[model samples]
Target: MMRAELAQNFRQLELKKKLEPMLPVLDFIAWSLLKHNQDVVSQLWVLSKQQSWRTSKSIPNSLWNWICSAVDEVTLDPMTKHAWLLLSDD
Candidate 1:
């Protein structure tokens, strides 16, 4: 059991390492989609998961949801929207 657990942990770590490089690109795509169409947030999440991006385990997923929910809940000015895009870029 210990050996299995250790193997799983190592696999997860390897996956994370592979994913690290793609994170910025994914974030940029998600942010750009959100800026134009709020309705596509769920689709973005689904696509991310489908691509094996581990959306639930990543910061970009949470950030995307938060920004989309905020936009849905309250009207953000253009400046605020741009700020979010800039922040997500980092």
Candidate 2:
């Protein structure tokens, strides 16, 4: 039953950075599904797809454009820098 619950909810923590100890859980999910005659490849394919875009709230194009333009690009003035300050090439 814990395996079934993990299988249902694991998608919420599937990213590489989030799942250091999750390999066994993933393996169990896949093996359990295979044992039950379910399609493992398709299930993995669905899990592998990026979900970041779906979780982020969608803003209208106009709003996005306005937000992007709200900040003015500023260049550092070397003449105004402190003598000991260093600037690195970006």
Best by lDDT: 1
Write the residue-wise lDDT of candidate 2 on 1-90 in tens digits: 698798767666566547745544554565446644435544553465444344223433433443475578778878898899897777
TM-score of model 2 relative to the true fold?
A: 0.22
5-49, model 1: which lDDT tens digit per residue? 999999999999998788767766766667667558657755767
Q: What TM-score fits each model?
A: 0.38, 0.22
Model 2 residue runs over 4 Å out of place are: 1-15, 36-90
CA lDDT of 61 in candidate 1? 58
Indicate the worst ten consecutive residues by lDDT in candidate 2. 55-64
How accurate locally, in lDDT, is each candidate? 0.67, 0.55
> What TM-score, to 2 decimals, does candidate 1 have?
0.38
